[model samples]
Target: MDELITVRFFGMVAEKLGKQELVLENPGNSDRLLEHLNENYPDLKEIKFSLAVNKKLCTEPSIIPIGAEVAILPPFSGG
Candidate 1:
């Protein structure tokens, strides 16, 4: 069975992906998720972004449970 993961994009990342939210299947971890995103959304590879899982910011290769909400946040710019 495939797992469902929710991905939310912010700022330029969202713009690049052309959406604020997306649903991905069988995302085992941040690593797999990144690979899937980069494959489907090639532009994602060119940008700098942070990964958040279940509202907590996480480094790559982190575990991603089923139904987890993953966020792609663009680099922050200070005013």
Candidate 2:
């Protein structure tokens, strides 16, 4: 059986994609996931975002285990 990844989009990212969440075939790593997203959603390339794996922010490409939950977040601001 193939592994799956759950992706959650936030803020403008969700608005652009028109959905808040998606389930995709696991790409194995963050880099591959980004590539897939860019190919499938070209508009995402024009937007800046961050990735969090299993609720933890990732600064670099990281391995994605089976059934991982990934969150795409737009830039945040503070008052």
Candidate 3:
């Protein structure tokens, strides 16, 4: 069995995914996860978003442990 990772999608990303969260198998690192997602959901490639692992924003690719908490945050506009 593959390792399952819990991933949360916020704002537009969630809407695009049609679910607030997803369980992925062996997502590997942040970059690998992006690649897996992009391969599965090509639309994600065009949507600008930030990735977070274990509640911490990740600007660069990093390892994602099994069952780790991940989230994808879309661009925000605020006053």
Candidate 4:
């Protein structure tokens, strides 16, 4: 098995995921990671959010090393 990475979700995604953080086997890179997530949580495909790898916003999937910190930020909505 590959190393494990942690993905954090904020706002709506977090609510849907039902947690703030998740530990998953590093799926090679960020793109694969998203695929894993989408497979695990098919609902994510329709959600609008910014993905970050190691605290940096990323549109492309990045390689997730062991213990990497990834985050998902949902579109912000305010009054």
Return the top candidate by lDDT.
2
Each prediction's TM-score against the native? 0.89, 0.92, 0.88, 0.87
lDDT of 3 by residue, 1-79 (tens): 3488988988888888798988878668998889888998787887899999999999888999887989999997876
Instruction: Kindly report which residue pairs in candidate 3 clash with one another.
Output: none
Cα deviation at 19, candidate 4, in Å, is: 1.3
Off by over 4 Å in 1: none
lDDT of 1 by residue, 1-79 (tens): 2478889999999887789998878568898888888889999889998999999999656998988899998996878
lDDT of all predictions, in order shown? 0.87, 0.94, 0.86, 0.84
- lDDT tens digits, residue span 7-73, model 2: 9999889999999999999999999999999999998998999999999999998999899999999
Model 1's alpha-carbon lDDT is 0.87
Runs off by more than 4 Å, candidate 2: 77-79
As for TM-score, the candidate ahead, 1 or 4, is: 1
Q: What is the lDDT of residue 28 in candidate 1?
A: 86
Candidate 4 off by > 4 Å:
none
Backbone clash pairs for candidate 4 read: 30-62
Q: After superposition, how far is residue 57 of candidate 1 from its true place, in Å?
A: 0.7
